[model samples]
Target: MSDFTDASTEPDANVSGATPAPEATPEAGTALDIVVLAGGISHERDVSLRSGRKVVDALAEAGHNVTLRDPDATLLPYLAEHRPDVLFPALHGSSGEDGSLLDLLAGLDVPHVGSAGAAARRAWSKPVASSLVRDAGIAVPASIVLSHESFRELGAPSVLRVVQRALVGDLVVKPASGGSAQGVTIVASPDDLPRAMVDAFTYADVAVVEQRIFGTEVAVTVVDSGDGPQALPPVEIVPTDGVYSFQARYNAGETTFFAPARLDAEVSSAVAEAAVLAHRTLGLSDLSRVDFIIDSEGRPWFLEANVVPGLTETSLVPLAIEASDRSVPEVYDALVRNAARRG
Candidate 1:
């Protein structure tokens, strides 16, 4: 891990070199730290804040103490001072989900909800995550990773030649790291490839070119308790004008969300099972949201996973629960109970 995270890291409270809190069991009904990490130094800082606020509201409604922090890396210090029973990182995009914070937390032995840092790092990067998860036997879109240096060294014409030879049909270009569809482009012709790569490079040094999977895309929200994890109903996304871009995501009524997404019983069950398998395969814990693209052949292809999916009122996960006849409070309450046991 990098020594100092992205230049905004808060100094350790234990600079005096005090030991971290003992890894002992947490008491029942203990008032928790419930830290909601928001406003990271990523492009999706605003989105993270929105998600964090929703999480704070939900956890507070469930009767827990909540502390909402912004784009600073003082989480470790906070854990050292006031040992919250558990941390709920509502951070999104790169700085939050790239696994740096998770590693720091694990180093402090602070038990937080969500996947581990390593897992988050892999899952946050589309190319790396897709490669690893696909090798683990999940169905994913065929893709290739291009390093900025490699592309620059090879020259645009040579890289384009390579791309022409390797990729077939329409291609989706994206930053290998982060989410919220921050830097992604769909190129339909050879002429658009250069712009796509440039757009993708705006987000990360590495870019991924993926085969466009055909069919409706759906995101499955799952929660893992002490017993085991369970998958909530899937939310199907239908973006207007053929782009499920940023505005479509945050803008109300821009896209139609189909909860319990119009599908056969068997199809829905299969999707849920795929989501569970993905969580396990990716080494995720506590909670995750698996995205999938159901192809023309009626097969579901994995499309990366979200360690900290959104929790806003317009978020898909909450909508899925409501569709399943469950309330947000009940779900989050179980997570708290589970954390208490682990604490």
Candidate 2:
């Protein structure tokens, strides 16, 4: 494992401190009424609230009138009444990423900053997203998607045997349609596979058991601010406990993040290209985060893609934003303006 402190000192021109020229879009100074939806009934409600507050603060700082609203029964009616210029969804997990809210927003003729409903559905399912990305020429791990019903119908032992034989290595078991590593588990021993499956099923009915790729884990955020999707500096994740669980992701100091990940120039470029490709393949817009593992040979293997990725203080996208010599407020401001123009 690379020492986090040492990696921070290494110089990489791709993520240098110098700011690049901003892409031309709607004027940044234009203030718009923005509703930021944060809290939902999903398991990630707390994280969503935190993300929402951060977004509200940043957009407000950028001179936009921002309202932090929860996606309760009153959300749609409130939007219909107020008709905010644009909506910034900071929701995570099923409540936001599952595409229902985006579809409703579309029905209301409200422009929001993120992927469309259809696209969000494609990206929300880890299996679906992986297949699409793989067809687009990206390397995704081999895995079997098992639903709880299947696990029950077929004997657990029989299914486990097939999975263990097919994957034949350390496996990463996670809920098929959620984020924040809520119920993700790393099973090195076959004895742990059954428990991992149970844990995964606790979060979602479907579970994905895939071959665990051992390498440096990194997250590349793609942002399309009217200039097409572009990749930000990749942020390397090094968790002290060897697993980026729910705690490691949300709690500060649990993981060491090296923004502009400690990859060679060639590898970094490839990672960025892969991230942009994943974003385009999944039909994601505005913002998304593509996670990967760079193996010993520097090949970037897709882990998953997040549509409404976390925007909390400890999130990867914000780290990448700062690493690219940009501020969170400005980038989000540009996204809001772009959505408003589309409307």
Candidate 3:
């Protein structure tokens, strides 16, 4: 666990543990030369770039010296020459989520935001993360993992029959890895299964077909400024087309969101508890967003955890941070300041 402490929960309060330099913001002890890493060779490249830009703006506004950098050959060499105090990796999809880049940062001894490489790999794989969370007493939908090679070599018809028999319900088909809902398909009809599998394979070599429970879809963002991970107020997602696709996620006005989730206090608290438990169970660090489907019975079923959640204007994490009575710049500033001290 990180040695950093929770700096400040108030919207405009100063950081408690650190004594700031006169010119620095009240959040950090000193002005940090922070790098916001964004824009990678991933399906969500555009989204990643947007997220990075937003983060850079927030950090700068909070009085930290921040720069946005893309992943390139020169990135490593540049970091070696002028190592920034902290790296807020604002990357999404395989290029960022798969843990390769994070592992590289650790090898360079650069303090960064989010989970370690190994833990990231576990959370990035939908099947692996679901299994681990389920083992930890969280309820997850029934699911199966199939690879492109297996679907082809072993025959798609037979495989589909087996999967359909085992998981009988409205299904959500998606890539095992990747983010921004790039290649997800909701298969409510039996005839849609084959096509959905094909769509999922376009985004990844493996596809995860899971039972889709009908419920209120929500995102609970878990952030650890210094204290252990705490769940922010849940954001209830209601897509006009009834599916939270890539377009609905990034496009403004495509979806309606409710902060605090309009849930009963008991349900809300339970959801928060489940989110925090999932964060710790997955060994996530810094921050994470746990997606869930709250069934009619008010049970929150685990969907997946995003270690590097989007920070775009329409993103749920920003909405949650705002609803929690905290400003994004203040919270992010404290996180960056704490990460720098951990190094």
TM-score of each: 0.88, 0.92, 0.92
lDDT of 2 by residue, 216-255 (tens): 9999999999999999999999998989889888777789
Model 3 weakest 10-residue run by lDDT: 10-19
Model 1 accuracy (lDDT, Cα)? 0.77
Top candidate when judged by lDDT against the true structure: 2
Pairs in steric clash, model 3: 5-226, 6-226
Clashes of 1: 1
The count of residue-pair clashes in candidate 3 stands at 2
Candidates sorted by lDDT, descending order? 2, 3, 1
Local distance difference test scores for all models: 0.77, 0.89, 0.86
Q: After superposition, how far is residue 180 of candidate 1 from its true place, in Å?
A: 0.7
The candidate with the higher TM-score, 1 or 3, is 3
Locate the minimum summed-lDDT window of 10 residues in model 2. Answer: 10-19
- The residue pairs found clashing in candidate 2 are none
